[model samples]
Target: MVLALGGLAVLALWGLDAVRIQPNRIVSGTGHGLIEALGTGPALLVMLPLALVMALAWRPTRGREALMLMLVTAMLAAMPWALSLFIGQFIDDPGGAARAAVSGASWLVGFALILMLIDLRQRLQPGALVTLVLIAVSLGSLGVAFGRGALDSLALVQEYEVRRAAFAEAIVNHLILVGVAVGASLVLALGLALWMRRVAGVRQGVLGVLSFIQTIPSLALFGLLLAPLAWLASRFPLLSDLGIQGIGWAPALLALVGYSLLPMTRNTFIALDGVDPDVIEAARGMGLAPLQVFFQVRLPLALPLLIEGIRITTVQAIGLAAVAALIGAGGLGTFIFQGLGQAAMNLVMLGALPIVLMAMLVDALLKALADAARRGDADDRTG
Candidate 1:
């Protein structure tokens, strides 16, 4: 996997278009390969890590896998600089409207490097701390790139400059929407799961309803809630004053929570119910109170799976929150839809790239937490 992905990165950097000089944002510009973008000496210099990666992949060792991880992560870190170098040297952007778009090859190189990082990390099975430091290095490098205005000539960065305030607002809104939805659904799912456990008759019906909700398309769900919410807001002016209108966050929040319920409830139910009776009995045998056994023993045992449900719900909410923009809910998706409407690809990237990064970040963080929980559980079992 390392060899294949590294080779692809090398091929893309050397063979495909690395940059384009757009006279303006709308018109297509002529493509230039890495050699043309950064010249012979620098372009060849950039390929060295990829070559090392290919060589290292030829011989597998614990040390070599770890080395490959650093190299791949360095490659990711250097990506911003690679573009910045080309932009700083090759493009003369006095007015800044002349866009130096990161064309096909550079983008592919970044993608390939990320894949190599993912592949290498899986092979190495590095601890969470190591993984997080590498991620920080990559992200920090990008932050530096932006802070220094190294990406100023780049089209996407330019778009961000135009809507910096909106971009910030979008990110905050997007996270808040996802966070609120996931949190609310978690509380609701927990209650429902407990109720279902106590009242067996409701299990099938509750699950069935949640399953049905899952089948409805997100857009349709949004539409379905629109009228009822609008009516309530009209009937009760208090609801209207509180911003519970049809075509805003109220409906979007409802739709997101609705879509989230099944996974959350199912996982919560499974986690609590799947606790070993023997373990619970052991706690009881220790002269612990029933509440203590349930809270201290069963809950701890069930935590990893409960966390798994949260991971699922949070990731799903991040993506769906983008769609909430359609109802004037205001998120990164607003830029996406507007960019599509205006035929501005850079503007779309402004909205999309952050979202993709956010999803990956949340997924990785939650997965790490779940893994830690599982490890703690295993240690307890053996000890």
Candidate 2:
């Protein structure tokens, strides 16, 4: 209740002028607040009812789940009008065309609202939360598609529109880089881990080398790969034909692969090594061959941890691939660097938001998979 009241107070006191308006490149312009979002009279009428509902919902007798649902609904309802008002402020610009863009306050409020929703979801049944999320996403998409929202006018949206083709291409390139690097790393790490397990004497040395590789900064690793890759391309016409080069995807993939090795190798080693000796013995006594024991028993037991390692490496690779743009490897980082060079904050956001969303979604999915694996393991034990 206190937190809800505090949030309300902040919203009322600071208002929700989350967007800044600039008229014809004017040196200064005014900001419109959510308090006056639908004009004074309408805003007052809307806010009073919403506030009353919230207050009523906060009472001890009212269900917390209902309160959370109501609050989220109210916030979503207000979003379109609030955004429209912000965009409307620039519509009648007398001087010339005007541009409206998100401000720092808007970003803060947006993130805070998202966090609040997530917190509320945590309190609800998982099935309920999933339903709510899907509903919200559907409604939000419909709103955007119907042009019922003002997001289209935002500078970030404009940047996306302008470079839509490039954005699509960048998405493809980013996936390719991450896919190839992770695939290669997984294969190599698995082989190395198996070999080291057989030859215990060299395990420490191999891990130490991978650990050293992990310690190197990503940019430095890319730089290190450049010379050898360049030499390989120069000396071998076949390598050049295969798209091997000092810069671009070659070094980017190599660097990403190198960074992935430590986590992948470590996880595989731990998972395989940690398998129960009793389980192994039972499999052998059942007349299972060495390879069969490994494939059917050890591998199945270790699968969850292996998947977890891939999840970690995949998330890491997605983010790092953005940095690969520095060496002419086209990805979302292209927009980020270009935005920085041009001093366009919205452009930077256009590049960044997708990467953030992708990472979050991937992390969530992998976590669910890991949890399922654990549950399955528990069930096996019980049986």
Candidate 3:
């Protein structure tokens, strides 16, 4: 799959600078969007290999293989478009516009590849479904390119290049924020939870504080952090000099971390509290120290719940991160806020589409991980 995708990207690079071929119409060419320029080439390349791999991996279950292939193809096709959308957010130029179009085309290819690989039932034939979608997209692209004056009134759409840059910026920043914030939150939550379970007063106080933080509106929480953060920023000249542009990303991240704490803490407490007391006493009677008992006995029993808390927190963080745009912390939120401010529905949709998709994807992935953990636990017990 990786090889195929790399080949596709290379193929695209080969023609990256070539003038696009367009069918003549009133408009003379497709109005440049991220999908039109760069997506198709890369998507096809990426999806082909992934679909093949999935088919091989699940060959015994044709239905599953088919489904997986179809999904992989769709994802590959969507990549170019997604890349363009993100890139559009930061730059405005014909070159950038072309790149954005290429991205959309790539995503389309991914979609097609997924469809092809998956063996689908008549009722769930994603291949047919995507084919129809591709047709519509192709027609739409053509209409915009060649329909002449039909779309003249829509000419004021932001330059694809600028939109693409913005899109790229939002994606990179959001991914980084989520990765770091979630990882840190997991660690902190785990540690805090352990302490609370062992020390009753500590658990109550920490939960109370986190719950309070959760109730505070995210935007408000960011505002509340501004003064102290700024003061600290000023006191540490090096931090200020680190070229950290604004309080936006940091504060937004802090807010998310704070919000995530509650789930982790609560889940940890519940998991630990629910543990059979006899188990702990047994471990102790075996000459285990307090640390050993918690780590060797309690932690193993509590792993499922602790993981569940992480999953919940991670999903919650994804949703809340959108609000970070209010503070100039760019993400999908930028598009949403920009559209709202300008009353542009398309822009709003453009921004919101990814956030919704990303949240769903992340949630599904995490849920799968948690379920696997639980299954492993069950297997151990049975064994």
Candidate 4:
């Protein structure tokens, strides 16, 4: 599998268009293969690490995963610079309307390397230190290249340069929407889950309603929310002054939290309910009070699944919050919708790239937490 991915990267790099040099931003521009973009010497240099990785895959060693990691990390770190090199060599007017956009070959090759990295890490199950190092190396190298203006001539970077402030604001708003939604949903779901437990009659009804909410299309849900919010704002002067309008964050947040509840409630209820009754009996055998047994015995065992639910809900919310931009809830998706309206692909990427990174980050962190919790549970059982 690893070797196949490496071959795909090689084919993409050697045969396909590495960049598109647009006369202006809107045009897709002319294709330039790897050799045309970076010259034969540098092109061969780019393949050298790939070759080394293929060789390592055939032989296999414990330490070689680390070496292969370094190779792929170098390839990814060099990706932005690779585009920078393309611009330096191919663009005739660097300071004018001319800009270079990354094309199919660049994206495919980069994605292939990222897949390779993920595959290696999953197989090795490296410790947190290794994981942190991976992040620092990947993001640090890319961030340095971007910060130094190495990619200034690239269309994506050019778009970012134009919207630097708005980009920052969008990122903050995106996170805020997801954060508040997850937090609110967590509290509500916990209450609902506990209530359903105490009142057995409502179990099916509660689950059914939550499932029904999930079935609603996001855009349709947003539309449905518009009127009630507008009525509320009209009925209450304070709500109107506070930005609780028909088409802004008021409806967006309500919709987000509504969508977030099912997973949170279901997982939380199952986690708590699934605890071994035998263990609870044993805790009572120790003469502990009911509340003490619940806290000291049940909650700890349930924590991993609780985190698993949060992880799922948070990742799901991140994507939904992007859609919130449609309702004037400003976020990274603002750039996406704007770019689509204006036919500016690079601008769309400016919004999309950050959102993808944010989702990946949340998924990884929460997954790590769940793993650690599971390991601790194992330790408790053994000790």
TM-scores of all predicted structures: 0.91, 0.86, 0.58, 0.91
lDDT of 4: 0.90
Quote model 1's TM-score: 0.91
TM-score of 3: 0.58
Best-to-worst order by TM-score is: 4, 1, 2, 3
Taking all chains together, the TM-score of candidate 2 against the true structure is 0.86
Among these predictions, the greatest lDDT belongs to: 4
Instruction: Give the C-alpha miss distance for residue 262 in model 1, angstroms.
Output: 0.3
lDDT of 3 by residue, 323-372 (tens): 88888777778888987887654467667777887887787777777778
Instruction: Please report how far candidate 2 places residue 162 from its true position, in Å.
Output: 1.1
Assess candidate 3 and give its lDDT.
Answer: 0.62
lDDT scores in order: 0.89, 0.75, 0.62, 0.90
Clashes of each: 0, 0, 59, 0
Error of 3 at 149 (Å): 22
The 10-residue segment of model 1 with minimum total lDDT is 87-96
Worst 10 residues of 2 by lDDT: 22-31
